[model samples]
Target: MRALFLSEPPFHFGVHEPAPDLPSRIQALVDAGDREEAVVLFQREAVGLPDAMIAQFRATDAFAGVVPLAQSTVYDATLARELSTPTDAMLAVDVPVTILCGQQTFPFLSAAAERLAAAMPHAELIISPESIGHRLDAHAATRILAARLA
Candidate 1:
């Protein structure tokens, strides 16, 4: 099995810092018809992606069809609220788990991946240097997963 940024209930990963009001800010940008700025803000603040990665992402078809402001805002808000609840299901998994993360991702994400791998008896953490921000290196992931399966 494989996972990315898995956290048990009450997702406490990062240092003690107040969460930024990202959804509102993004919504405002979108509402103002500054969709490009909204994308930049989302990449920088929410995803912690570097400028180069952000530029590359902006060129993608997925970026062109990013969700509407209202839906995105609601989703982000709900995700924040939901992450606070605790669950023990993750700890019960018995299969070998490969936790993959990008070296350039948010520090908290890397920390969370590390912690999850540490806690899981059959888990391994792989931080791919070729990855950008929260994006995975498809080639590297394919190679690793294939090797594991074999």
Candidate 2:
């Protein structure tokens, strides 16, 4: 069976200009054992999101669930570091891999997807036209995956 990979690793994109201090600030909060505060800070100070969007996310149950896993972001950062060096063994998996990126996402993310697809023999990269920045249109993505799986 084939595997699908969605979203670029955190390190794949350079920091966006609006929130240059985000990573360090979140790290500081985590280091101080304030995981919830870290989550709050992340939502409040995310690089590209406007204030209204952040408020909308804050009101959602999904965001509530995400709050507890805030510390995992640190782990994600670590994983990104590890994945930075994509060795032959890492790319040698024989299964088909689909790497999807948003068309309007940060340029680095699209570039990372291209790099990954080029490195892996069985991987294909798709830039979704229906996507907005890093936010993909879920219905469009679902339909595409369903067609592929079918």
Candidate 3:
């Protein structure tokens, strides 16, 4: 079976430094029922997308559809903690695993992809140079996946 994994945090990756206060700050907004502000704060601080891009996205119908789900951002803090957990059992599977990362993504994520590729016997890593931030070029990715499956 063929599988495509995108922007997956490495199992062995660890950030020992204290996390920024953004999570708590966002959580506070969520707790206070200001979910929209929490989402905006996360997009501004954590996602770090350009203001113009964010504005354009916010104008889209898709953004409006998902706005109500912003309250779930509170749970992201818990999910972030679990990202560093070991994944030896999953990596041990013999099926080929393709890990795709954007070349312009954060350094730590690239490092994690490299480390994951090293650990998995049947895994390969691809850094898409044309990708932006954490978003991949889906057309290119589909071609790569097709070749692998062939």
Candidate 4:
């Protein structure tokens, strides 16, 4: 995944050397920084936004870009439009990719995961029994992901 969804490169190296107050202090800093960075990048990259849309995007950068290894856009027209790929992009990776989608997300991701696993040959799909979310339980998810990737 490298820095696919990270604003900075350091964290990708497993060097997350957070301070004693890192948990408490980092959120505000990362939130603010990620927001500002995403806005600038999107404004530069995304074009033809309605004025209102632009104004709305001005407030946050949460939509900047997805971390490649992270579960992302629901598989749908928007995702297809964003990716413009009828095929699974994960197939191209040298490393195998495992998609663990939230059960609550639009059904397309689960459907797409199956289709992708079929098409990609090297990938795996695991739909969580429970709905997944932004701050999902990392420990449990990690175990699932690790087993699949292994």
State the lDDT of candidate 3 residue by residue for 15-128, as single tens digits: 442255767888888888887677777666554545786787788896776567776655554455555544678768678888888878755567778888887888889878
Query: Candidate 1: deviation at residue 31, Å?
Result: 3.2
lDDT of 1 by residue, 1-150 (tens): 443333212233444322457677777777887877876776566545679877887888877777344346435544654553224576557787777777777765676677767777777787778776566777977877787777
**Candidate 2 per-residue lDDT over residues 15-106, each given as its tens digit:** 34224455677788988988767777765554334568667777888777877788776554445544554667767978878788888875
TM-score of each: 0.62, 0.63, 0.67, 0.39
Off by over 4 Å in 1: 1-20, 48-81, 84-86
Against the true structure, candidate 3 reaches a TM-score of: 0.67
Ranking by TM-score: 3, 2, 1, 4
Give the alpha carbon lDDT tens digit for every residue of 1-150 in model 4: 521110001111112122233222323433555534333333222222345655664555544433221122112212334443333344465465565655544333445555555655555566665544322356657677566545
For candidate 2, the lDDT comes to 0.68
Off by over 4 Å in 3: 1-4, 8-12, 16-25, 40-69
Better of 1 and 3 by TM-score: 3
Per-prediction CA RMSD (Å):
4.9, 4.9, 4.1, 14.2
* Model number with the top TM-score: 3
Clashing pairs for predicted structure model 3, backbone only? none
Cα lDDT of candidate 1 equals 0.63
Model 1 clashing residue pairs (backbone): 9-86
